[model samples]
Target: MEVSKKKPAAGVPAAKEPAPTLASGKYTFSKSEALRRYLSRKQARSGKRVSKAKRDEQKKKPKFVEKPFNKGTRIVSLKKRPNNYPCKNHSKPRSKVPKKHGATKVRKSLQPGTILILLAGVHRGKRVVLLKALKSGLLLVTGPYKINRVPIRRVHQKFVIATSTRLNIESVKIPDTINDAYFRRIREKRAKKAEGDIFAKKKKTYKVSATRKADQITVDKQLLRAIRPHPDRKILLNYLKSRFGLSTGQYPHTLKF
Candidate 1:
């Protein structure tokens, strides 16, 4: 049997087409329609007008009022106290003229090799091995205070000679005078220089081993000993051995006591 092919009538409406589906499976609105809907909601929110009763109530509210200043009231002024004022209640008490230890008595001038006691300066109460008395009446002591050239006036009168090797002393106060300040600055600078020197020495010592290789010829242990001759002997020896291919079993014969 032959099938007949026929066209639909022009007056009849075609069958409704199925809606297109996106990956999200949601119905999508046209750009213009979506924008129109958004603008409608914005207009609804912004178009609200203030009521006349609310406006009247706002107008009736009180405003901030400024108070008048009184000219007769007194104002107090604050100022800082002077920094040079002596410390309260800690002033050195004046010593009464003793029957035995009379005031203004000329004691024998301190000489070289005399162990003087530092009574008042930064190294106060500390017994220093006096090197020499400078023309300025200052003592040349060893250690950190030596660089400052601290004056003899700072030392207390309670100094005794160092007959034995061991000595014991206490710390002292640093004066705030101009001379003391100058001395302190000099001490600080010298300390920094000393610290730099120590660091430089350490750097030089460390550089010796770093430049050498394990397979290279053994280093002269005498040269290493001259560089550092203290408690770090073992450490330096081990480092030299590792760096210069020295035999592990061989003791470092160049180390001097």
Candidate 2:
């Protein structure tokens, strides 16, 4: 910002205008007189915004320290508010464990490298490897989809069957499981990079045809054959046959993934 002090008539005092500081240098100048006014106004408006933001941020209540419970204490008495309850209402709902509904209890705990059969979802009954346990108590499993039928994704722990086979895959790092917010942030970042017509049009959707289905089966067979060892393939094949009567074609079968 530039400042101009107009000279007063002879023997009169010169007009006063302060010099621009380093921080308030974002002003646009068309004329010296306008520049001084613009900088002063802009600085004042910005300072007000900064102070308001800081004040609003400070207004948020901090998480209070949890104190030990004592029956004699007024805050902890059961007749009043208990020590376990929170003082403020949270915006998000608390997570709850689903009620047990006679679900089969597997004694084995799932671990990385564990091969599991998906008991539910689109890839039900297909074999997948547990890449890692997710933060949300779900299993991050993958079928190595390019080679196997199962696409990489997080699966509910309840819907997976822990198979006895555990292949060694500790060498690879599993990517983090993502939610909608993660993708939304990515889209916002990309939007900020360019303003108009920057994004490509969404691709069209299509229904699966018999030919696509046939091709998928062929791909799954080729991928499984190339990836799985002779012994492991034999076990998976036998399991599939026994579970679905694949050999006799007595039961309905689904697409591999």
Top candidate, metric lDDT: 2
User: Which 10 successive residues of model 2 have the least lDDT summed?
Assistant: 180-189
Clash count (model 1, backbone only): 4
- lDDT at residue 251 of model 1 (Cα atoms): 52
TM of each candidate vs. truth: 0.18, 0.34
How far off is residue 17 in model 2, in Å?
92
Per-candidate count of clashing residue pairs (backbone under 3 Å): 4, 0
**Steric clash pairs (candidate 2):** none
Query: On residues 187-244, what C-alpha lDDT tens digit does candidate 2 reach at each position?
Result: 2233344455745656446545564355445434443554366467766544433332
Model 1 Cα RMSD, 1 decimal: 30.8
lDDT tens digits, residue span 1-257, model 1: 99996767989877765555567876466778768767876766898555679879987764543344485544332434577977679778878976564333223545443444444546544444444433344444432222223322323334432322221222222222313223332222323345445455533222223222321112222222232443665653333232122366765354221
Model 2, which residues run further than 4 Å from truth? 1-108, 175-257
Candidate that scores best on TM-score: 2
